[model samples]
Target: MTTTTATYDPGLIDMTNEANKKIKVLLELRPALDGFAGIPQEVRLLFRGLRKIESVDIEGLLQTSHRRLARGTSDTGFFRKKISAARRYNRISNVIISMAEKPYRNVLDIIMDYFQKRAEVASLQISMVSGFGKIKLTRFESKSFEDFTWRTIFSKTLPASDFSLVAPANHRVCSVPWHTLHTVGLSTLNWRSTPKYPKLDTKGFDIFIGQTPYPARVDPDTAYVIRYHDAIPIFMPHTISDKSLHQATHFYAMMSNVKSGAWFACVSEATRQDLIRIFPEVTDRAVTIHNMVAHHYFLENSAFERVPGIIRSRLYEGDPSKGIELLPKFFSLREKENFYKRSLGDKHFKYLLIVSTIEPRKNHTRLLAAWEVLKADVDPDLKLVVVGTLGWEHSSITKAFSSWIDRGDLFMLNAVPAPDLRVLYRHAAATVCPSLGEGFDFSGVESMASGGITIASDIPVHREVYEDAAEYFDPYATMSLVKALKKVLYEEGAQQEQEQMRQRGGEVSSRYLPEQIIPQWERFAERVVAERKSIKSSTTTVFEEKNSSVSST
Candidate 1:
């Protein structure tokens, strides 16, 4: 993965019309790397936000009408297959064509031809062909990114691509030549500004965007640009996946596949700092591009709506200072009602909400412990509403979750639909986020945008994202969280304070809006092309020198 390092700048990109500024791209993709069943939910959910404007067939609105069985599953996995089948084709046509009434889906166009296998990068360069995983490859055309998102949600297997990570609503990357691939699982969650480098067996495009590393001994001319998320695995070796060798590389590869000469688009300033800490020399090769929030879904306006009456009745509070009437413009009435019936079920008890993967790093155990103390004085009927699928090291909280559920003290909505989630956010007494670390803390921001009071772990990322908009607590101390929850829930004038906090939270969200993010991407694309050309010229000189030496020999 070694290469001649080059300078990278965040303020560079082709100034030509954005629509016309297309680069010859070679994406190194691993479509079937599984979060569960050969797919990374982060990348899949990203496609769900593609609007009709980005590309007509995107969202697969015009995908073939008839649905069939998914590639690998048998009749026993029928339910899962059915959900997958609907998502891959035709499911979102109505929503885009008829129901889409807002300009929220407007996003920057990212056009590229996708390659499903690592081998494809070589074949496409040398032979103009490649193969992909049978199960995941076929899904390229059949599976709709929009459908896969919610279907995975209902199936309770959706990986942790929370909206705050802002995949779909922010990006519009459409793989043009990708039409032929069956449906391979795209494993990357971020590729928006991944222009960076190394070598490959064959060469055409100077840059590549995908999960696979460049072939070990590649043509020095090939530049592999990787989307850098975090340096967590390198610093915290324990977090590295037991199944993969991606974290293991030589000197240049030690810190990352990122070598000296490649351009990288990091997800946050914090992430850029992580890269810099490992490779101080990479200061010029990396630039910080903050992650965006799906403001369209959580703020402004949304496609779904519930009746005002239903919302008013459910969120009824005699206090005038209570958070403003929940915005019904965002919820699907039927969906919200059904969710309520299933979760709340004829009960009118107030609830506190937490939306995130249930794992140790997320610090859910502490939240549970805090709730144990808070419930004693706060209202016995106040339910802890936990939303999200389980993640690794969840055994620590399994007993706690089970005991609470069994005692009817908590409601576990593992993977509710987007609309139902918005409903919960709007009506909940307040949302809690007690994570220990994160590349970005979307839950806190999302809770605020959804008009819920957010009490977050006083982590740097949370402070960066929520600032004074949220009530902060020491994540390590259950008492701190208990106190914060108490102040937001039981303390007098809490409603007015929360309502004001929600407004400030809305203001904070503006920074992560897509408008604020798109310019960073445009500049990133520009620098990538400029650097590639510069390195390619250097490679040409090397070739000329080699030829002269051969002639003399």
Candidate 2:
């Protein structure tokens, strides 16, 4: 084998020039492989193209080396041929210039630039769990009133006061503040194992915000803060095998990060109580912050439109129409038999809307059963539209939908688009969600925001979100739901009652606006930072005293 060296002017052979040369070589060499046509055309073309660029430059050399190995070149003679080609390519003065000015001068240098730029900004430092992908900060805008309330508190309040938002890469909710925090998008699945692990700056952040408690032996150097998103144990027990063990583990993990003095924020007073009950030692650390809904949702916007035709089609196609005939009974006017007629008649259907995943916890089965009984007894014009996906863990619960597949008085729609949902809420006679349990019922408040009367389960979270603006019902009592539905749907003065509730819902939802909640978050964060600093000083003093006593002994 012999190496070929071609010397050319250095300035003339840049990336573009080299690339053009490689292309010209490939075009010239294509006919040479035709004599041995046993190989596929693609394979032959690839082989010739790689050989043409083998002596061009570093990038070309690297690409050629990869191609030759992929083609199964085991012969020492063939290896020597490629190696000689690489040496010959380096000797080409033009090729040397092209390789010398590599695109990325130093990756580390670019990263350092990013760090320095960030240091100059009035930024929040936040770390998030990224298991699913980048945390979508924008999704917070569309969050249900419950989630939105918590989000506003964290993003506006906490960060303004210099608290750092940190969580596992998979933690979805906390990652919403990435834009403010200067953390990379939530999609990056990088987890830091130690305190100051990301180590952007050794001074360390003022406070660390986490949903789950930190593991034992966390770096003592950084202050740990915990915010309880929900009392999951109280509501989601059926979803877990052993509630006690889960609570115990959760309690242990949360306390491990407390370090004798740390601030804990909870979504509601009920959640704070539950946390203290489960972890008595951490009771002193907890503070209750009632969740809030954004004000815009509660305000009437003329720009808001009804559900789109395509989304409505996707949700209602092939689904049961059991309650179609009952529309006249629920509402005095039955304009049309199908959705098109109902949508076209008055532009707003004053009917009940139920938003929930089709599962047992949502009590869809009993709701359906009660609806069936009501349909048989009443005139039946009011419509019941069930929206949301069919989640798992409920075998008996899901059967009700299947049973009512052809019935005209009932309707089941899974996963309707948000715009349509908003429209549905605005036009609804009332929005009803009688869940067995809920961390914070989003549907009820959203319904209220849309100026619809809200009927919900008698849960503490619901009370906090709805206050006295919602009609409450017992989850197990089918008749209670039926009575509430009938009253809201058809009783005299029902419309007046509905309007009053809507007004109150609008008033209550204002507190959750970004402006109101953001400042509160700022104060909470400042307090957490101050408290953590005090605790650290005390711990240091105790450690020094113990060391002195041991040394004297």
Candidate 3:
């Protein structure tokens, strides 16, 4: 086998093209390979890789085995043959291999070094301002973000966390040692003056992460990383308002600045892609890092079996044999009758659980309608348990829910304990989420984690996370949702499908575990810091050069 060294032409591929832009950036940042050099080892490896391509006959190379070479999987024989062929064509082998052994050292170094640097950083400060305390930044404050300084503020309008504080806490708030906390309930302040107005000093912090990009308190110079949870405004156009429009524009602007400055992290790739589609300019800087669940939340088999007596008692209070009417003040006569029948036997009623606030975005009304359609065909013993507090300006939903309450098929638990919710997920025949939109459907994932088959909306984000594991249905299609629900409840292979979903859920759950996701967070923070430093260095160099030139003149 003769050696065929092909003359490599870098120009054959326009590095500036959108397809190769990311690679181009990587190559541009490539470091020189010198152990005694001032540049980082990682950068050195990157430079070595880029130096290998010399010159080439673009068209001729393409006509030969260029495609395979482009793929970076060409065999030694193929490489040798190319070299020999190039020699025959009177083409000089311009490709250099002086530092080929250290080809990818710099790129890997950049990534690893960033992670290492993030771990070294003294502390992180995050500010969470959202309608609901659902994202409860404080929850993670004890674990993943525990080492970081945290500040949280919530809208007083939203509902509070269901459970009370646990006693003898293993984790203390003061673990962070340095934190400036505030609760600006429902107060909307000017974005520009927020830092000074709130007396944050603003200079001490490394990064500011928040739900709203245009927080009244974020300093311009601070690294602002915004959370893009859901496209609720887009998915439900009616939800859009002037305030929302301002928030969206500010979010886009903040994203652009962050991308140019440090880096921006998104909860999911689907969300990151959506953000890119809406604001194409920030595509280069956006990264996906999954949200995490606390370890203590994972209930054991015994814990699952040990349903709180309070929950079981509340669920089954009346004696069916004695014809006793035991009812809560919230239940109507029809609901009371249904509860009476469901409580008749010693055996508990299996439920098809749907847990989400009864908001339009959640599409609860449609789910209820779908459930009604399936009720006639399915077993009467199995109930549709809709658990959540009433939410927002949904009068029609409230009225419909009242009507459902009159019927015997639906059971509504206004609020339940988290452990009880977990039991619901574990025991339910299937958990259905017929939402029109979701940033990250916590309920759906929770159900999956608890070994329940999830029937979710067929949306891009859902598909990205669940992949082929979930039984997807179009939210707009009532028949599709009804069919899926029916299949989950009554199909012949339903048990096997549920088991498969349970396994998939377990696999997917790993990504959300604190142990798995915290390291990724650390890596992301490090990259942002390094990238910011690089940008600052370039700016300083330009400024110094201009100053020197002026002095010389």
Candidate 4:
């Protein structure tokens, strides 16, 4: 007998078992192309965390949701030609669709609409399967891709000072836009009981993980996983930007993913419960593995003097003259100068912070109302700082903010990098998360991680994620938030309670670090692979037994 000992590599997981091959994962990279926050931030963090696990070899699948990628194109000419062609086709299709929808549509118009629908199906098929088997994959060493990689990976955190280059080794582009494939699949939903999903040629990949519910199907041999965020568009349609299309896309894609045996890795228990509420059968397949907080947000000592500079430097540029009419009657240059001077050195210079987009669902107006009351009664020196880019339906919020902004009492900042945001978090009187809904609100945990106090809406996710680390208030009631703010930020004899919350926060936030979360992902992947193997083994055994019985007969 010969004995063989397998030496393990310390960097990766020990693979001494029968199946020694590394699990290959193709992670969708579409979300990372957007702004450096929300889903994009989570996608980037997942990529970075997955890279550190030795048991898995992961590559990025580059496919835009709304933009078509050209096939067999050089790096320089990837989407330009396809986009122009798509736009031209869209114009013609729109004309036909408009004619068909009109009350006085003629036979000619009806014929054209039928042909147009046929042409769309044909185009969708071509886009989906064209050159799928031998599709050429581009590497990620290109300057543009490298820049994109770094921006995505380090968006929510400060990169190491000594860090130079970091990117995935392999990346493949899919010619069909995700939306096209999704919509084509959705065309079947009206007639079929179970909507037929468009198929993706997932040839060699062992696993395909999408950031949301994908509208395409993978091979039965491959496991498809969704990093499910939330079903906001389904439940709270009024809050989202595009009610009809967004809700349909999310609900239909989710239905397809569910029917196709796709596993879900939700960011919170609350999110997982939402999934189960829709499809009870998928309860076994869905699991909760919380999001990873950036490594940049540990407790740090920083001066309050830096806040003004950070805000000014990152201020979201708006039409300075458009809101001039809304400027206060008492607005004066002296007070503005005095505000800056006091922010630089005054001991009483404190600001209330809200880090979210200027959107209705974020409940910015409610927070603003509460802040106004606090300013008038609690502390006149208290300023309000809002940090986020402009989201849809923000005209009213911006309008409400115009007078305060002109008076230098309100600041709107955007594109703040993680290091600067960390400083802001640490020095602020309190960071407020006043969202109407969320999968796992990042701001509150992030504030806690940065040694800052948090006041969040009294939502289920907040209770689950923030726990003892945050003060809670009713999202709908302005007075409730005002009362919570007083207790957390300004009430007498609350310093001891605040200090206790900070201590609890440090411990709570540590649960979301990469080192802690990555193991959960690894274990989930292993379990999925093990189940696949068990199914395969059972199928083979049944097939062999049937063959034996047939031969005897």
Backbone clashes (count) for model 2: 36
Would you list the C-alpha lDDT of every candidate in the order shown? 0.50, 0.46, 0.46, 0.74
Q: 3 or 4: which has the higher TM-score?
A: 4
Cα displacement (angstroms), candidate 3, residue 116, comes to 42
Task: Write the residue-wise lDDT of candidate 4 on 242-343 in tens digits.
Answer: 799888888888888898888898888888888888899988788888899988789988877788788768877764575523223347888756765654
Find the candidate with the highest TM-score and give its number: 4
Model 1 lDDT tens row, 1-553: 1112222344344444246434444433224222321123323322332221131112111111112211222223313445455433342332233222311221321111122334444433332212211211122332334344343221222334543222232111221123222111111113312222222322333445443222222234545555565565566545334413334421224333554355656655666676678778867777766555554236434322342223334342112263322112225779656655554553456777888776677788898888888778667777777776556665557656766664545655543544556667777778888987666666666667676688899976677667788899999999999889888778998878877887887877676666666555555555666666677788899999999999999
How well does candidate 4 score on lDDT at residue 149? 49
| Alpha carbon deviation, residue 459, candidate 2 (Å) | 2.1
- Which digits, one per residue and each the tens of the lDDT, describe model 2 over residues 1-553? 1111111112322222223332111011112222211111222222222222333210011111011111111123313444354333232322123223422325864675366345423122333331222211101111122232223222221222221211100111121121222223211224443221111121223444444342222134444555465556555766543566555445444544454344566655666666677667776667655444423245455432353342346444432364322122223234234644444344433356788766667777667766766666763555567776545554455455554544433555654544456667776667787877664556776677767678887777777667888888777888887788777666898777777878888766564445554444444444554555567789999999999999999
Residue by residue across 93-175, what tens digits does model 3's lDDT show?
11111112222335854585466334322122223223212111111112222111111111111113301111111111111
What TM-scores do the predictions have? 0.61, 0.55, 0.58, 0.82
RMSD of each: 13.7, 22.8, 22.2, 9.5
